[model samples]
Target: MKLTEARQQFISNWGAFGTHWGINRTMAQIHALLMISPDALSQDDIMAELNISRGNANMNIRELINWGLVERVIVAGERKEFFSAEKDIWKVVRQIVKERKKRELEPMLQLLDKLENTEGDKKDKHMKAFLDTVGSIKKLSKQADKTLDTMIKAEESWFVGNLLKLFK
Candidate 1:
């Protein structure tokens, strides 16, 4: 259909997908809007376009900024701060993966480390089972952490090519 309709659909779908990534819908929509926009947008512009309140727009924009997906930009002769998304899709994915690993995987791995250090006797079957389970999870988490770190550092061409090779 129209470009406007396509943009709207993309923003809506991106907002929905954000929830799966531990972000709120509005934050993702704001990110989507900035991503597709030709230039930076002010908070007012974001609110009007997203049909959200000023507070909602402000908060989500701030959150998106914290996520490293958006940044504050200054427009010539404009007092209102404008925001823009990281237009490079590879950088966006890397930042998202970095943040997620820091927030989720790292903490889980820390807890697993403590768990594997249980004070109970290993002769107990339940204790043995607990340690074994924790050890397995720790192993997988460490592997994932390494993999994500590599992805964050990898160039897009090499990364995508390597992924394609894995499926071949």
Candidate 2:
């Protein structure tokens, strides 16, 4: 495929993938554009390139900044703010994992903790079933929390080496 065509396909696919992960399509497209661009781009540049409205571009850019996936840049001679993404894939993955754990997993675990303690006699079959399910979920969530914590803290080389060993 031609370079431009390939880039467009990539941006489209990235946007679709983002929607599956609870992110808006435009935000992911903006991220995809920034990821592939050779230099930082202004809001106007982003809107023009992505064919999105100014407000849409602005909101998504701010969201990306909040997620630590992108950053603002000030050109020496330019007054307009420019944006750039964290291009290192490993850092990008780590940031995503950290944010998801805090936003999704942590809250889920907290909810399960509360649910597991619902007021009911343990001898009741209904209550027993509910508690058992919740307990199992909490156990798995705790394990996942610990594993994700280790992954977030691990150096890239160590993580890759250990992961390879596990696969083998």
Candidate 3:
């Protein structure tokens, strides 16, 4: 495929993938565009290229920055702000994992902790089942939380190498 076509395809795919992960399509599209661009793009450039309104571009760009996926760049003589994505896939993955863990997993785990302690007689069948289910989920969530924490701290090479060894 031509370079332009390929880039468009990538943006489209990334935007669709973002929706599955609870992110807005416009934000993901902006990130994809910035990731592929050779240099940072101004808000107007993003608006023109993506065929989006200025306000839409600005809001999504700000959201991307808040997510730590994109950053602001100051040009030597330009007064307008420009934006760029992290671009390194590893860093991108780590940031996304970190954010999602904090936003989703941590809260769910907290709720599970509270639920597990609900006043109930374990001898009762219904209470036993409820406790068992909550206990199992809490255990698994804790393990996953620790695993994600480890991954967040591990160097890319070491983490990837260890994971590969496990599969082998």
Candidate 4:
């Protein structure tokens, strides 16, 4: 396929994938465009190419920036801001995993910590049941955290690819 067509295909596919991962589609598309483009694009260029409004483009661009997936660029003699994506796919995956863990898992772990330590009616049946359930949930959360740490660490090593081959 032609470069332009390939770029568009990547944007659409990545955008759809992003939606499933809780990121807005346009933000992912904007990142995808930057990832593939030979030259960094100004906000206006992104807006016109994506057929999105200035606000939409600006908002999603900011979101991507916050996620550490994109960065602002300044062209010589140009006052307008341009953006570019971190093009290494593995690095991108690492950032996404880090961000997701911070946003989702950390808060849940804190809740589990607080709920486990809360001293309520110790002799009450309701308190007993709640504690039982919370204990199990806390255990599960710890295991999930261990799994996440293992996965993240494995991604940086050769073992991940080796293990994937076993499943295949």
The stretch of ten residues in a row with the least summed lDDT in candidate 2 is 18-27
Instruction: List TM-scores for all candidates, in order.
Output: 0.98, 0.95, 0.95, 0.86
Q: What is the lDDT of candidate 4?
A: 0.87
- Tens-place lDDT digits, model 2, residues 1-168: 999999999999999998887689999999999999999999999999899999899899999999999999989999999999988888988988898999999999999988987997999999999999999999999999999999999999999999999989
- For model 2, the stretches where C-alpha displacement exceeds 4 angstroms are none
Number of the predicted model whose lDDT against the real structure is largest? 1
Can you write out model 1's per-residue Cα lDDT over 1-168, one digit (the tens) per residue? 899999999999999999999899999999999999999999999999999999999899988888889999989999999999988989999999999999999999999998988898999999999999999999999999999999999999999999999999
Clashing residue pairs, backbone N/CA/C < 3 A, model 1: none
**Per-residue lDDT of 135-158 in model 3, one digit per residue for the tens?**
999999999999999898989999
Each prediction's Cα lDDT score?
A: 0.94, 0.93, 0.92, 0.87
Candidate 4: regions farther than 4 A off:
121-125, 150-155, 165-168
N/CA/C clash count, model 1: 0
Error of 1 at 11 (Å): 0.5
The digit string of per-residue lDDT tens for model 4 on 53-148 reads 999999999999999999998899999998999888878887888788889988998998889787888889999999899899889988988877
Off by over 4 Å in 3: none
The C-alpha local distance difference test score for the whole of candidate 3 amounts to 0.92
Would you list the clashing residue pairs of candidate 4? none
Judge candidate 4 at residue 130 and give its lDDT. Answer: 92
- Model 4 poorest ten-residue lDDT run: 151-160
* Prediction RMSDs, each to the true structure: 0.7, 1.1, 1.2, 2.3
For model 1, the stretches where C-alpha displacement exceeds 4 angstroms are none
